[model samples]
Target chain A: MPKLDFDTINLGHGSGGKLTNQLLDSGVFSVLKNDLLDQRHDGAILELSGKTAFTTDSFVISPVFFPGGDIGELAVNGTVNDLAMCGAIPRYLSLAFILEEGLPMTEFWDILVSIRNACAAAGVSVVTGDTKVVERGKGDKVFVNTTGVGTVHPKAEIDIRRIMPGDKIIVSGQLAAHGMAIMSVREGLEFESQIVSDTQPLNHLVKDLLDEFGNNIKLLRDPTRGGVGTALNEMARDRDLGVHLEQRALPIDPQVAGACELLGLDPLYVANEGLFLAVVSGAAAGAMVGAMQRTDTGRHARIIGEFTDQHPKKVVMTSGIGGQRIVNMLIGEQLPRIC
Target chain B: MPKLDFDTINLGHGSGGKLTNQLLDSGVFSVLKNDLLDQRHDGAILELSGKTAFTTDSFVISPVFFPGGDIGELAVNGTVNDLAMCGAIPRYLSLAFILEEGLPMTEFWDILVSIRNACAAAGVSVVTGDTKVVERGKGDKVFVNTTGVGTVHPKAEIDIRRIMPGDKIIVSGQLAAHGMAIMSVREGLEFESQIVSDTQPLNHLVKDLLDEFGNNIKLLRDPTRGGVGTALNEMARDRDLGVHLEQRALPIDPQVAGACELLGLDPLYVANEGLFLAVVSGAAAGAMVGAMQRTDTGRHARIIGEFTDQHPKKVVMTSGIGGQRIVNMLIGEQLPRIC
Candidate 1:
């Protein structure tokens, strides 16, 4: 780490003065240095072509540092995944921070390093950013906002309008890990095993899927904030169609399930950071799942449901106990700041 | 008001659940609806070609509302002006919010309307965004992050590398108005006259200047958080050149000057929301200032300083009484949350 006179950030660090410059030069710029960022202009100049995808997300998860990942990693991965769900090649990101005064310099440095590593892992660059500090008690440790821009995959025509009645709904990997991890930490809960947040970048995996499945991939949604159940309900309502699911096919880590059970929470509604829900054509469902299972990001890929004409604007699941039940969208706040 | 049952925003509205959908459907979406936003996809798809400008900023100004403008208006214009400084015609924006729970719904609605009006006024669209609600006391009322994308102007070539020894420094309008406005409200220091923020969009004025001046314009920067002094100091230090300013030429409103005197603050270190500093070729400086003064955004335009060969990498100013003083970048915080 670059040497600094202060151990914690102060209001002057965001004052757009000498202290702000010192903080950026010795801290953020040193960690995430790039040609575009080196320009040091009001904005980054980029070359973008064809259909570009633009998205923004603000992450305010409590406890800046979580079990498996920190807020910095989550900020980068969250925006990257949002772009990936659009069938885009995530390229550039703009990171902005709302830092609370008195935050330790070490913590700030760690977050910057995490951001750098996350960007390198996702194959994207943080081209521009802004930092603002609020007085103590006015903010938490840190709040991050990441906005991503990417070029849409040429072969991909992923859209909700393309969903057919028989399209299969698939889930990539296990669910409820991210939400449970945060809850466990917040509530001081303990279990037989540890629960870690599954916060990882899904851009590369998404690129591979789009390259192979092409137009057969009808839609992709990351089950973040609200989990698989909420995403499926949104699809059903938006398409004015029904989603039929097999409960036995739903994937969940044993630890996450147990924690959910202990907390009286449903895994279906819990958030998933690194997981995604995909809607693909029936003819390619088996082959797609097979391909996805071969990759690290989708080892537990499962064809859990299919769109149907019955029960329009609703999601119905066939349980392992042989009873059918309707899965409505999440009603109230099950968990806050659970991203 | 779209018949919301609640009087204030709660954590559930940001949980990505039923209440979240209700909030979006009745509030944010209804106010900021457009073709791209109406799609309601993970991201907005736009056909952008050639050079693009991307930038992000988080607005955490206290009080939420100020004398001349609110945080919503400032957030939109701030990002737009950043793009303007890059010689880009801002086209699309991604808006994200970190809201504190218990904020009244009426206040939220008013902010939303202000955002809509500002977007319309600036000719930009809010395409994709995310909202997260932090518990009361975890955050202030609201913090907005706006990431903007714009296409670069063809004739514009904005680069500091083109700065010459005789380059003229131009201030688009009066300085310290925005800083004093926020200070007036925050400190509750009453003056005989009101000090209103000069928060306005400078994109059109910049476009016109670029269209006419082309490569003659060397660099452009908005004097936002650090005022004109800090911005000039940054340029001088980066280019390893000297900046000479005439204190008499600096424009400031009478009330603003008096407020700065009372607060023991230097106008040079104050912040400006709707002003910019332009570096132009000495030969075209007079013509450019004349042309700028004809426009609404630059009616108070003045040639305050110029790059000089003396005092390399430092800013020196001449007083009206014929004495020179070294104007340094702000050292520590004078005012926080002025933006």
Candidate 2:
């Protein structure tokens, strides 16, 4: 095995032969050995019941390794969050890796370990997977796509159709940490304090909300690539409700806010991987925020805004100076590949 | 609409904003206008029952377009075939695209149409999707990852445990056309007759076979990236059964064989898109072959091999010249990125 070991990925590792087996056995399977994936079949078969939630996401962040998380970690958690947003308890995930030739074996191994650890932390299994390698320079170092499958809870009726006016909107935590962290590294900025990506799995937090509220949870959404502003805008447009936010209620870490100000960016439109916005019944808003605050992942939970009948399908924010301003979805990407 | 029109995809198109909506509305949403995808939620909700098969594949095949099909077509059909191989009626797919900055909008639109057409051909809907843009050189023209979800039939009991000695092995069609098609184009070889890829969805053929033989069908698999030889080797290893292939019985197109020889390649190791191998009960083998032959996609189907207890978990090929040789999986990719 030592002599047959590869120092870096080549076309052979993806050939589905001895080399492909070596790579999987030594790197992937060695880290994430589960019954389904270890079956080594083309696909995984499971006995699932009730409604199922399916979601897919491709992670092409510039730096494969980031401040708080790498692309591998983000790939798994992001997909998990998408399923969670639909009130599904994510169970199985299929990972596909596109490895560029010449990517060092150490880096590849590192990402595989990250993926395994993330799946374990999120209480999901890496069930079935594929690996394909391209010629050098034809791709970046590595790109990962994860597709998640989970069973929807019968009591958890979550959708935008139930997003009625007067529903309370809640933000899980501080905003823009994920985006600001990437920007600082890309810009090589020397801030007084370092900003790290807030990349964490939000399924457990969403589970807590669903456990407490059952069908009262109107909707849940994760602000990833396009940030909170875009998410609210989309929810409003789709649900035919207006979102009104109080500037002072939005939670923002002073350091992250300072970094955003330094970079000429608006915090509302910057991505947050660990944070999510939820619309709940007005009667349960107080208890929802209380339950969220009790969780380790949502200590800074705040009622940032609420849905209104006025200005249907639009989002508006009240400024600190008591001025109302329309907050539209960002027409242009302030940051590309922020995911 | 003119001001909001999209000519080419830019950073904004993936920004999840006005431009993203325009691109999705004009291209993705217009073609894949299913209820789940049109819901515009973070994920698609499906009412699935019983055993579910989940599979994922990332298509990074070079030369995005080739003789018979492009990456988009392969993404859909390939996934459909994987799920079908598990005896699952391929139902829904999730498409995620990583587009390089500056990729032409026309090519993007063309690929989307191809994807939609393939989905229609396979009778599966593009339920949910995501699009992301990376800076130029960070990605190839476009890479698509399709994750397919399908439900396993009640009587369709397919598994490796059913594989045993005296079982018959069947091949769906001619081998190596896909690999040779891309190889010819990449090496700039001019052949008297062009070897086009056999890239077609085989869900209907699988359905026909399943209908004919419910639980008698032991196993089904597509011989895609690593060709038939690799696929059989995997099946043998997983099922702990010997696969005895007859060289003279393998259905290889003359042009494809000639091209493989001229290129110093063995057709056994070359990839094929629209082909599969099935192991059925000895009693039902003849009926299975007849059913496959009646289908257009499996018109060239043949009983190329059988299971034997002579050498468990090994694949041996009896050549035309009366010699037995172990047909091991390809140790290295003969044609990388052929998909």
Best by TM-score: 1
| Native A-B contacts reproduced, model 1 | 0.90
Q: Which ten residues in a row have the lowest lDDT in candidate 2 chain A?
A: A1-10
Residue A108, candidate 1: C-alpha displacement in angstroms = 0.8
**Poorly placed runs, candidate 2 (over 4 Å):** A1-4, B1-4
Please provide, for model 1 over B167-236, each residue's C-alpha lDDT reduced to its tens digit, 9 standing for 90 to 100. Answer: 9999999999999999999999898988999999999999999999999999999998888999999999
Listed per model, the TM-scores of chain A against the true chain A are 0.98, 0.97
Q: Candidate 1 residues A100-143, lDDT tens each?
A: 99999899999999999999999999999999999999999999
lDDT of the candidates, in the order given:
0.92, 0.87
Candidate 1, which segments miss by more than 4 Å at Cα?
none
